[model samples]
Target chain A: MREIAAVFLSTVRMNFRDRRSLIFMILFPIVLTLILGTALSSVSGSSDTAEKLDSRAALINQDHGAMAGRMEKFFRSPEIRKIVHTKTYRSLSTAKADLKKQKLDAIIVINKGFTQAVENGSSKKLDFITSGDMESSLIKNITQSYLQRINAYRAAAAFAPQPAAPLLADHALSINGKIPRSSDYYAVTMLIMIILYASAYGLNVVREMNLSPIGYRIRSLPVRQINYLIGKTLGQLATVFLQIIVLVTFFKFIYHANFGSNLPFIFLVCFLLGFIIILLSIALALLFSYKMADTILDLAIPVATFLAGGYVKLSILDTNPIAVALNSWLPNAVAQNLVFQNIYGGTGQTAAGGVLKLTLIALAILLLTIAALRRNNHADLSK
Target chain B: MIIEVNDLIKRYKDFLAIDHLNLTIGDGELFGLLGPNGAGKTTLVNAILGLTAVDHGTINVFGEALSTSERAIKKQIGLVPQDIAVYPELTAQENVTLFGKLFGLRGEALRKGVADALEFTGLTDIRNKKPSQFSGGMKRRLNIACAIVHKPRLIIMDEPTVGIDPQSRNYILESVKKLNDMHCTVIYISHYMEEVASICTRIAIVDKGRIIAKGTQEELGRLIEDDQVVSVGVTAPDYSIIEKLKRLPAVKDATVDGHTIRIVLSERKLNAVLDTFLEEDLTITKIETNTPTLEDVFLTLTGRALREGAQ
Candidate 1:
């Protein structure tokens, strides 16, 4: 145990002392975050950005179930009235004509059996017939948020101490009908980017690791390889956490960056991503030579970061078909989207599902690292 | 036996690193592995440490099979590599403490071991200093301090004196002797003949991945009691006279370099070898007779290419 702790602490100290790693991991991300956030502050959403959505939306509820009636009541409530001015119509054709005439910003059609589908836990169709997706996505998120609250209310009402309401109107307004300011957007993405950069820590330690001269003295001790490896991973993981914490705290206090209220989930995503990168870089440095691993990292990290929209949101995956068709399941991309959705209350991507996906990636990288180390026995690591 | 190896063979593709070598070190023995670079000194050491896979060998450390009991065996052994392996970012005390802790020392034992290690290596005054702030000699001492912090039963020093000044080298060498005196078995590996001869109680001359000669310093000197080199400098070293000198019964082999005729011959029959030189049509410009040291015996045995007289 002492041996493992020693290795763990020593690895952390080594990583911190590695000037290049420190500059890239901690300092680079902070500076970039500040520059990108401040310069592009007005782009995402400025002072006039949070203006009312006021999208003239037509609500055509075809289902006679109480659930569909409740949806109608929600659209007429003051909460939805503050965002979308809803008008009721009996036929889809009439609403479609009004949408075509530019009289309505969107037409939301609740198909029949919506209540039955909810009760059966089956898929329910809620169509957003709007030409502009950017505007419709917010109203759609509000409607989806209402349905989720209904499901939760139903689940919780089975043993209710009191007959509580089916939904709280505030959740439907999670989007606040406005995208974040550039300062807020970059603040979150830059933190994610720093988590990705923590892979340098893994590369540095594994470069000296294994049975090489620099590591041979450590390996020569009585400790087992597994303990040494675990100690290494924990140390790198801790460094990543430290970097994230320091950056987040600095950005929070000094820059007043909008990290949203969901700090725990945001941090969870960062932690998992940090773990995957650390293990992945370890596998890279072990499977390949240090120089080769470094080259791969240098080539891969920035490209992946760009694809994940770390530098700037140049091409959104939803809008750009080519970007969406890339078929790469980038953990950073998933993490960013997950954080974005959780904060603004977008489509129903359960936090558990995203976390599990990141966890699976981490596990796979851990396995790869193990396999790499197995083959790396007797292989020179110092070079 | 502290460590015993039998029929160890290690091959790297086409090149053979350790060639069916064997070695044994007794308790409290200051054993020396003397070899030039690539002579398999490191390869053999790696095999013993279970770092390299051997094709055919059984290494027993502390009466336990090395392969089956590597961790247990390593727990009792400390290795000081040829290169300085201490972390440059860590302080002298931290480096020693980390190594000791890794070897299972804790609390008071850990603290004492670290302090003792620093004191033993004469680095107590700079315990808080990093390797970047230290001289090469200080770094070398720090390297040794890291290895023996746990006070292992056997300490393997692999050319620990290389690249350091004479004073530092002497200090390390004396430290090796003192460690052995404290009943810690020391494997002092080096290619420097004088250092090995002066310190190691039992020295093994390694060449071509084999122990060419291994014994007490006095015993190895006797291996060449009858061996002597006679150098005769001539104005014009005739290539023809070299063949004539070789024909003499006492002269084992003779060669001429520049303008000097060198003969490897028995000391008792030196006169016979010299008589031919007098008969030659050349005046003996200079003549010198020198007895062979253990290094000469090694060079003659291995027939390796030149290093002057160092190896």
Candidate 2:
């Protein structure tokens, strides 16, 4: 027991002593908490009390196709007008000026031949311009989301043997009755990215014990292999858990980011997310060479975050039912949804489900790590 | 006996690492396992430590068979690996204390062991400094300190002075002698014959997974006891003259190192060797006849230089 604790304490001390690792694992998060926290606070600070804010958007229809006319009418309809103050612009120059002056949150220009392309089963691009703020970016995604629905309906209409007389029928996607403030979305996304990057902790600590000469010395001692592995895993967990605490506290005190009424639950969700990331790093360490583990962690975390809708709200995974089914089970996606649900007043069922998925993944990775270590006994003994 | 190996055989695929080997090391004896690189010295050490499984053999350390309980047997042995195995990120004191705790030393015993280890290695002044901040010699010393911190009954050092300066090398040799003086049995493995001859009371020469010879320095030196080695220093010695000297009836081997020519021959051929230099008109600065060294014994038996494997 004492030997295990000594291994654990030594691993922790060694990780802390590595200045390069400290910069990425601890200091980088704190600095990001300061820069991103302060920058996002200005965008989210003004509208804290309300669940939704009225955003102003401009529409420019330059298409001569039948589908383009229908899309223009949908933006001017009463349903979109209630949430977005829409204005029709005659030219692109005026819309650009309003966006520059912050008068417009976003501007959507439906390109010519959009309807023709949809009719012929070809692709056409839409030009989107925003004020470069989080709110404006959300507005831009919303506009693009509506365009996606029109294309889907067009495809459905073409599939029917009997063409409907009214090709420009009205279609809508359901909203959850409450839209989260853009600031809350910003805070949650940042937290998700930070938690996933917790893989750095495992990459450093495990590789030190497994690959370095210190490892051989430890193996020659009376210590068991299981005790050594357990010590290393716990050391990384402590480091990542401590990071989550600092980030959550920073968001709370500095940005006044609301995590709903249940603060402990919010903290618990973040902790689970860190645990999952650390387990992933351990599994990765077992799979790849020590020199390649860090590089893999560096590339995998950011790419995972991007796919889980960390950079944009209501991403492709949100609208595509098939994508939604696949991504919902991913650790990053599950954690992302959990943070959004907890802060946006979601029912406890979704949050519980997300926690369950994360817990299952952590446990699975833990088992695989143990198996990999056991299988690696002969190779390690030779060294 | 502190360690006994009987008919040990270890094979990796088709290659045999240790083949049907037998040896015994008595307690409190500085027994040396001498061999060139890839001569199964390390393989034998690993087998004795229970780190590797043998195909058909048994090893007993401290009256306990290694195949039985490894952890219990390992507690009584200390290993100083060939490589410097100290953690670069850990301080000298932390490295020692951690290893000490591995042997069940706790509380005051752990602290005292760590202090004594540092003082013994002459690294107490840099106790708090990390190995990365240390010189190469200092890191080597730290490696020894970590191994002996637990004060095991049997200590196995495998080429502990491979790449350090002479000062640090001497320090390590001195420490090994002192440990043996405390009745700690040591198995010193090295490719350098001089180091083995200097400290080890009993030496075993291993080659090709087998012990070809084993005894004290004087007993082993007697392998070539009939041959005489004569050292002759000449000015601007020509290579052809040394070749001619080797062709003499009494000359068994001749080597030229700069201006010195060493000839191995019978004592009766000393006058004949000197006459060759005179006939060749080479100036002789010095001449001396000496006894055979361990290197000579090794060369005579193995037909290869001890340092050949190093290249």
Which one wins on lDDT?
1
Error of 1 at B16 (Å): 1.6
Steric clash pairs (candidate 1) = none
In candidate 1, position A66 carries an lDDT of 87
TM-score of each: 0.78, 0.77
Show where candidate 1 strays beyond 4 Å: A41-176, A320-322, A325-328, A377-383, B231-263, B267-286, B305-311
For candidate 1 chain A, the 10 contiguous residues with the lowest summed lDDT are A164-173
DockQ values for all predictions?
0.38, 0.42
lDDT per residue (tens digit) for residues B1-311 in model 2: 99889999988778688889999999999999988898889989878876677888889998789657779878888899888887777899988887898887988888888998899999999999998898878888898898888788999999999888999889889999999999999999999899999999999999878998999998898877998888899988889987898789887777787899878884456878888999999999999888988877776677566777733
Fnat measured on candidate 1: 0.71
Q: Is the docking of candidate 1 incorrect, acceptable, medium or high quality?
A: acceptable
Candidate 2: list runs displaced more than 4 Å.
A30-83, A87-137, A140-191, A204-206, A255-263, A292-295, A311-314, A320-326, A347-349, A378-380, B232-263, B266-288
Highest TM-score: give the candidate number: 1
